[model samples]
Target: MNAWNEKYLQVSLLWFAESARNKADPSVVTKDDQEAYLRQARFAQGFIREEEPDPPMARTYSYQQPHALPKVQRAFDRTYATRGTQREPAAEPFATATQSKHMDHGQPTQTTSPLAPQGRSSGQIQVTGQWDKTPIKLSFDPDASGEAFYQTFFQWAVKRKRGADLDRERTTLWLKASKATPDTQAYDLELKEDELEELWNTAVEWIQENKNTKAPHLYATVEMEAG
Candidate 1:
């Protein structure tokens, strides 16, 4: 059997039996049960991680900071009552007019944007979740088998169109794979929970649209667990 078929068989059997046996065990988890329920799932994400706040600043200024000598008699006169301070004489009348001609307020400021990755991402697919499968190479897509084909549909989600709070609800992604495929290289992608949900939603949307024309075996929506 092809690698895809073998994995499909194993995943199906596992979710059917093993999951039921572990319903009471929090360690034995399930997610997207309404869609693709499994002991584990794998995917990658694209989001900026939150950073910790900076430490509070120390008191910098000192009362005697400007004094160079230790014994400082007040040489300077304090005119606080008079509020004594000399102001600059009014600028020559010509100063404002001469500088006004060069006012560059309307001109656009040039800015440089950092360059994006020049080489295209040869990244195959973001996921290659596996199950107990035979080691035989497949006649079709000998390298990636079928996982990449499904994963490509989900990878289309850009950052943020993916809803928030999706990750906390999802299961932990396992990098381990049962078979080696061309797309296997991307399987190790360390995707957070949010990214996985984005991909899952995108793939399901694609499957929903192409159900009749292409792969009919795939369907939309998560499978509600039989309670």
Candidate 2:
């Protein structure tokens, strides 16, 4: 009953009508035929006439184990503080004294705040506030009420500190309403594919980095609800 299935049904019906009208051929598709009926239909009808749409995507929830994420490599060199330049034992007693060149250990720079996330970590995370300006805001359609559900979820996130948790880069959150059809934010939610992909990808990458960091009992989620 996903959106893609509905589309396939439509295409099959179309092909059946066309074939019957033209008396192209008589055929029956049995369960054991084990052929892709939709593909056959498309091939017969010339698929270019009607492009296939992306199907209703299934996004399931997940909880990530506490872990570390790889830090973003900075283009510019970063400097860090070192405890009193403890000189290593001289190669030779008469070796000329020389300062040690800092070796890159991929550590954060000295100026980096301790709490500043180098990667996803465990424990309560501190966060700041900010507004996310939609690139092109869409006017709310009261009749559909699809968008309203999304707004409600956003508000819930703010109230429940989901937004804060996400900001801290310590959690991944995906808000998807379970649907038998490809709603694409049509009835219970509202979002374009690009936006959805961005959200989904961001959460996925967050989960990946957290796993790499290997924090403890870390939280990663793909939350679904009956909208």
Candidate 3:
């Protein structure tokens, strides 16, 4: 049995004892009274309190020490590259000839790399380096806005070439986006070592821009296992 069931049994026994003691007349207590008391005790013993499970502990897991990625094994790979820019086409043929303001400033904008295709299979890229050694979990508020918030975050991450692994069929991005209710849409994000800082910054920025004014109580937590 679970710890909660054990606790309920103990509480029921105590309540039964107290109820019996509080009876007005000890001599008046009869067989029916005893049976009713026992039944009540049994019912109470069967009761289970409903409560949320404790959030998982968070801490950083360092895989930086030295690790090997064997041949045919999958490893994490990240390549930082400049994201290209797009130019708007001219509205009319001769409109821009005489205008002092010029478009397409001849500068290549620098941005994070675009996300790779989502449906493509992760090939046999090996994970050569170690990752965070400990597990991490995070929770978020649940609501319609929360659902949209996580979806945006996932799309942002996926678009940034950060969502895929050679060993896994599909990268798991956000854990519980669909279940975010107005009251309780807590979600979890598990991260490896290098992703910790990036994830935290993204979450902070998201909260500030999206829910700061009306839902200031909306919050997120970053957790890592205790070492």
Candidate 4:
């Protein structure tokens, strides 16, 4: 089972032993039960104690290494040439000009790129990506507001069975895209919660129309925010 369940079991057993000892006369205490309780207690304490000495070989391990990542070509195909700039006179498929203004999360400021779309439209897209090397997928209507989309993602992530392992405050969602490459350079762009609606709509539009056969699929990454 999981670590939590194992710890809980140990704790429960320890409590049972302690209660039995307190309620029963000293002469009635079983040696086995007392030993079990002491073992459980020690295990529980191990979870909190951090002053334990390091292994003899700890200092010998190398601590520095270059981070390596794949290099992707920077090109936009079948997607809009501009993002968040063109307003559709129809049912408002794109974020308004005002909305796009607040969405500055480290993207190149160029006005022409398939990473941006011409107008808004009604459709749905599938988002597939990684979280700590684990694949994850989610789908939602492209018509939804950026805020709504982010909320849906946030809820899905934090409600997972082992969600406690995620540190929400230091976690952020990013969309992977191509940029000038050293191969080691990061391509993921953060999706800020406040500007998410505008940013998401722009991304969704581009992904829906992207026609480059070799273009990377529009994927997301649940990243631990770097200090």
Candidate 5:
């Protein structure tokens, strides 16, 4: 089997075995069971692979201009110095517009939905999101694969923050797409794990067919888990 299929099978079998063991003896684990679990864990480890750093092409694609990083870093430092904390939020860092009516009025007004009236847009989708109470927006090619969509989103998010590079592993990210209307339930989804490609595709399909007149707003949050 391919790497993806092999890893999936390994994880599935591991979980099934664990479940059966728990059901057989919820209160206690015999030494044999412990050894059995370790063996299963070792079996699963064969399918695992370590993550690699972003490639040179990825850096170029995401940053667009390498020289711009220095400027952004200087600005980030100034903001952090003034705030006396590294967690100072970026001021609409990913937004295409410096200021909008939404910022002026302290209320969210539709800045221009990227969705084509009849169906999916021919161009990139302008996704709007709020992070740390700061409004941000970014564009994505709807035609891209779901994995590409997820990666670009995270890369953009990390670039917009002050100290994201330092503690990225400790961080957990998630998205909550706004409700179609006041009466509808919102779409809440997690990131930083498996099944993300499916989730992203589902989100795109939802946006395309949603009943709302405009594209729904997206809210993103990043949390650092305690060590």
Candidate 6:
């Protein structure tokens, strides 16, 4: 069998054996039963090859070192001699215009400015943008595997709409997938608030269009909030 099939079989058998042990009756520890379990375990170990040994170690050294500086003290004296001191009168101011012609025209000019109260807090509007994802499950045909489905959907839905608004330097997208059963798959898309609504609507349309074989299930709810 292939590596994936082998791994799946091994894990499944291990889980089955563990469940059997947990649910086994207290009175059923017969010699025959013990022998059968041991034989199965041996067969599993023999079927799975041991991993290859790691490579030889390489020589390494720490080159960091500290140094101390020498302290020195020296004294030199010079004598200052002054001949005389003189005072001069200040210059008179020139009669020039103070106003300039250039002014910003893009924004509206304010005639009356709001007065601030003494010892009062500044009333500035601070915008705190946030986004979150509800638990969403989307199903696709078996042919559409890996992360391609979610990646494609996101590129068209969330990324396209909010690509400009997103702080590419700080933005991130998270996806969670689950294969609860061999035939069923679920995917959850997590994104920021500015793109959440667009993502939701686009996802609904995408699932409806792409999933033709079997009617896929989709459930979305806010999981957590991020700023």
- Top candidate on lDDT is 5
Residue by residue across 1-227, what tens digits does model 2's lDDT show?
45665686787777656555664344644443324565675674555445537645579879877543334223122222121233444443434433224545586556655676655333322222222331111122222233342454356566655554322222223222222223342221124434443454444344334322321212212223333
Cα lDDT computed for each candidate against the true fold = 0.36, 0.38, 0.42, 0.57, 0.57, 0.41
Q: How far in Å is the alpha carbon of 8 misplaced in model 5?
A: 99
Q: Predictions ranked by lDDT, top down?
A: 5, 4, 3, 6, 2, 1
Model 3 whole-model lDDT (C-alpha atoms): 0.42
RMSD of candidates 1 onward, in order: 57.3, 49.6, 48.1, 45.3, 49.8, 52.3
lDDT (10s digit) by residue, model 3, range 102-194: 746676656699787764233211111112332222234332243343444345335544334211112223322222323244434444434
Ten residues in sequence with the least summed lDDT for candidate 4: 70-79
Which candidate leads in TM-score? 5
Cα lDDT for residue 65, candidate 2 = 70
- Candidate 6 lDDT over 79-111, as tens digits, reads 111111112122212111222234557766768
Ranking by TM-score: 5, 4, 6, 3, 1, 2
Measured with C-alpha atoms, the lDDT of residue 97 in candidate 4 is 60
Instruction: Give candidate 4 misplaced runs (Cα > 4 Å).
Output: 1-122, 162-189, 211-217
Candidate 5 lDDT (Cα, whole model)? 0.57
Q: Which ten residues in a row have the lowest lDDT in candidate 6?
A: 76-85
Model 5, range 1-227, lDDT digits (tens) per residue? Answer: 46775776677677656766777576665777677667866655554433324323433444555565788999988987877744545544545365542375756566676765764454556566556654556656766876676576667766777434424336554444542334244454445446555566786776555423344444445556676
For model 1, how does the per-residue alpha-carbon lDDT over 30-62 read when each residue is reduced to its tens digit? 555524542333211111111224545678975
Candidate 2 accuracy as lDDT: 0.38
Q: Candidate 6 at residue 122, lDDT?
A: 33
Residues forming the 10-long window of minimal summed lDDT in candidate 2? 134-143
Local error of candidate 2 at residue 123 (angstroms): 40
- Comparison by TM-score, 5 against 6, better one: 5
Residue 128 Cα positional deviation in candidate 2, in Å, after optimal superposition: 28
**Residue 14 shift from truth in candidate 5, angstroms:** 99
